[model samples]
Structure formats: C-alpha cells, structure tokens
Target: MSRRPPDGEAPVVTAIVVAFDSAHALPDCLDALRGEGIATIVVDNASTDDSAALSERRGARVIRNGRNEGYGRANNTGVRAADTEFVLIVNPDVIVQKGAVAALVDAAQRYPDAGFFAPQIVEPSGRVFFQPRSLLAKHLTNPGGKLVLPEGEACAPFFSGACFLMRRSFFLDLGGFDEKIFLFYEDDDLCRRIADTGAALIYVPQARVGHGRGRSSGPKPGLVFKSRWHQAWSRAYVSRKYGLPDPAPSMFAVNALKTLAAGLSFRRSLIERYGGSAAGALAFLRGRSALRQEGLS
Candidate 1:
C-alpha cells in the first residue's frame, strides 16, 4: 500500500478495483479508464500474479496485501484511502463503459434519496446479470439472465456487486461491507442495510459495465469446493443478519439430493453448488459468520 501519492495523481472519483491474481483481465479494465482522471486504486488481495505492478504502471495507486483479506475488507482499505466525494467499487474483471462514471455521478441528483448507483452489468455471454429483480429472488442457482428490469423502472432495492458508484460518506456511514462475510453476499448485507436506512439503490442503464464471469476461480474440484463452502457460509450469515427466515433445512435437503444426483452424473459444478448449500446449512447450524482460510491457501 502506498503511503504517498504518485506525483500529482488527481481524479474526480476514487475507483477501487479489488484484485486477486487478476493480471489476466486487468489490462482491459485499466485501458477503459485511461486518462479519465479516476483515482484508480488496485487493492491486490495477496495475489501472486503481477497485478499490483501492472496497476502501478498504469498510474493506479496499488495496495498489496500481505495475505488475502477477502473482497469487502480489501475494498474498505481503498475507501479509507479515498479523498474524493464519490467512490466507485469494482472488480478487476469489470470493464467500465465510456462515460459510466460521469453518468452515475449525474444520476445522483435524480435520486436524491439514493445511497448508491448501480450500472447495467452485462456478462461475457451478452446476458444481463444481477439486475433489480435479484433483490428478493434469492438466487438458488446460476442467475444467468433470469432477472430483468423494464426500461422505465430505475429505482431498485438492491444492485449487483461487480460495479457501483456511491457517496464516500454514505459508504463510511454504513461502515462499508460486512467483512465477516469473507467471500460472498457482502454486497447483499451492505445493500440491504442501505435500503433499511430509507435510501434508494438506483440502477442507471446509461452507465454500463461489462463483466467476465468468475475469472479468479477456475473450474477445478478443490477450488470449486472452497468457493462453495464460503458461498454457503456467507449466505447463511447474511440471512441471519437481515432476519430473513432461515432456509437452511430446506436448502440442506434439496442440495443434499442434488449433490447425490450430480455426483452420480459427474456434474462437477452442480456438485459444488449442492455441496455449497449443504455446507451453508451446516454454517447456519454452527452460527458461523466468517469462514476460515483452508484449502484455498
């Protein structure tokens, strides 16, 4: 992490990109913001790849963690370092569309009661993901373009996690995302809290961000297991924190059956999904809020 700013680094909005071995997809992300005067902060979550250096070369302020601090915590560090009024939190795999930052900033006036602004998120497959419909749908499986908001409906209860712009003060007041979530549902926890405060989470289609799905976790058995376990743990914790009726027992039953079927059919991804649900149910039983680093290290 830099204690000193690199020369005269002046940016209108501080954009924090949380990276974990993200060197492969980072270039395109940075290129989209070239000369945009966005104070880019790349918080490298103990990535072994050259992510920090690559970001530094692109004039981004780099914060290299000694070890992985998870997504929410890493973004918190960048938010703390930000001096700008506006802050954009993004993942390294996200490509910001032209004028997106400005559009989000401009839309802030239209939504005077908003706590944050989310842009249209397009997947590599040309599909929409995590749109406003996802606020209460409670994703049971791959959301894969399942939710859509009509052209006129702009106010949303919640927004996607990949990219969003918000007032720095609003984020600080919420104490940022709950770090206890570790790897998943941190956004859900934060967004719901904002809604509870009677603040709108507006979705602006004019501002768009392209997302490349799941670059960090490749399709491997062990990694998949790690992701599933954490996903389960986080979902359970979020449900409890928000006072949503516990779906643990039902999730466990359905997923256990799915896991058995997937195992028989050799569907590794589905197997992991079911395994995650089972693991989450166990997490709910244990009242665990955070997941310990295990095979992932």
Candidate 2:
C-alpha cells in the first residue's frame, strides 16, 4: 500500500535506498533519513545478511526480494511502492546531511520543469564528486579535463545514480530505469531519455550527502569481478542502444590480450579485471543479455 500524508499536509518526499548485503552502511543511512523526518523505504535484493531486518528496525518500510534483482530493478520496486510526489533515491553507503532533503525539495519547486534533482555528493575525504559532462561528450570530446563544480542551482548533463531526487510521475512516465541494464550505465540511460523529453536535470549544490563510495558491496573479490563484468556489459549495451560508437569490439580485443598476460603472471586481481571485461565484451558481441550471464553472480 502507498504511504501518503494527509491531503492538507506538505508534500511528502520518500527516500528509497536499495540495499544488497549492505548492513554495514544501512544504519547510518537510515538513521540520517529518519533524523530528517523523511519517510524511507529499503529494498533488499536478496541480501544474504540481515539488511532487511536491520532496515525494519531502523523504522524503514522494507521490501524483500527472493532473488537478487539488479540495482535498477530493485530501485524501480521502491519507487513504485512510494506514494509521495517526489522520491529521493540514494545508495545505502550514503549519509544524507541535515537540510539536504529540504534543499532538494526546494530545488524541485524552483525548477518545475526538471525531471531530476541531485545533491552534491561528498566523499569521506571531503572531495566533491560531480561529473558535469555528458557521457558522450566526456568520451568523444574532452577525454581529459579538469572537473568543474557548478554554482548554486544549475542544469546538469546527468546526475549520478548514487543519490538523486526524482518526481514520481516523471519517473513513471519514463518507465523508471531500464531493467535490462542490471547494474551499470542505468543512470546514463535514464538521463539520455530525460534529455529526449527536454526536461532539465538539475544539480543542487546546497544539498549535500556524504558517500562511502564502493563500500556497499564490501571488498569481496567475487563481488568485485561481478561488478566489473556487468559494468563492461552495461556500457556496451547502452552505447549501442543510443547509437553511440560501440566499444565492445575494441574492449574485447584489448581486455582479451591483457587477460592472457595477467593469467601468465598469476595476477588474480588483474585476471579478474581484464578477464571480466573481455568476457563481458564477448557476451555483448554475441548478443547475450547481462541478466542471463551465468556464474557471475
């Protein structure tokens, strides 16, 4: 059932945190959201740990999946379950700063035509993480350039999937994230579609969230390989889908050669990195679906 506030009350914004074995990070993430008095929903993607139970204890509505649905699909589930007009999608490894939610809400109202609003994501070391370039432009035009921080409220090329606020109706209209993506490049795909509709993707620097980047999945080598593999596959898929120059052929050749060298040197991590990309590229070239990749998960 949808959780909505009374008609006369202020518009409610729900925070959706998609968790997968993220018990280590959920407490802080959920606690910050609860502290801000924002309703939160935690979608557990078949986590082997107590992520679901922990979220419930933290006063969050929990949705438990029987099997691991990919990140985008799990987020789609959370967004659908939310009854609010606006929803904040955040990673489990993120701690929402005080007033951040309100800042995003304000930005939403200020930019009525925007389909998405993103908070400034800060790393543990206090470095700001903001990518102002579009994916195509970054790769094709400026391969190496200094990252520039936007001032105040500004239009963004694309917001990071790690943390962002999106209108529920606009999200639903775009059909949410593409489920076929499974993991990586889902944000790029969504942003591309939003651009098609000519809706702005606003970046609100006043809002801030501390992100423990790459900590949600932990440091399991198997998980690392899985992430790398899906990243390559998803990148190839999105590039092809949007008529961008396909990188699968070149990716496959380079990674395949590197994989052979790494295997000869007995470098396990390098083997995983190079071999995963090679396999992913080959899979895409052969018309294999990312979701159907066996033994990776």
Q: How many clashes in each structure?
A: 0, 0
Residue pairs in clash, model 1: none
Residues 1-297 of candidate 2 have per-residue lDDT tens digits of 113347688547989999989999999999998888889999998898889999999899999988889899999999999999899999999999988998998888888988988899999999999874656432323346458787777876677889999899899989999989888899988988887888888889989999999977656657757777898999999888878899999999999999999999999999999888888889999989987884224
- The TM-scores, one per candidate, come to 0.85, 0.93
Candidate 2 ranges with C-alpha deviation above 4 Å: 1-11, 136-142, 294-297
Worst lDDT 10-window in candidate 1: 133-142
Give the per-residue lDDT of model 1 (tens digit) for 64-178: 8888888898899999998887889888888888787778888886676789889888899988775434423333323464565648437666677889988898899999988
How does each model score on lDDT?
0.77, 0.86
Clashes of 2: 0
Stretches > 4 Å off in candidate 1: 1-10, 130-148, 216-221, 261-271, 293-297
Q: Where's the lowest-lDDT run of ten residues in candidate 2? A: 136-145
Q: Which residue pairs in model 2 clash with each other?
A: none
Q: How far is candidate 1 from the true structure (C-alpha RMSD, Å)?
A: 4.7
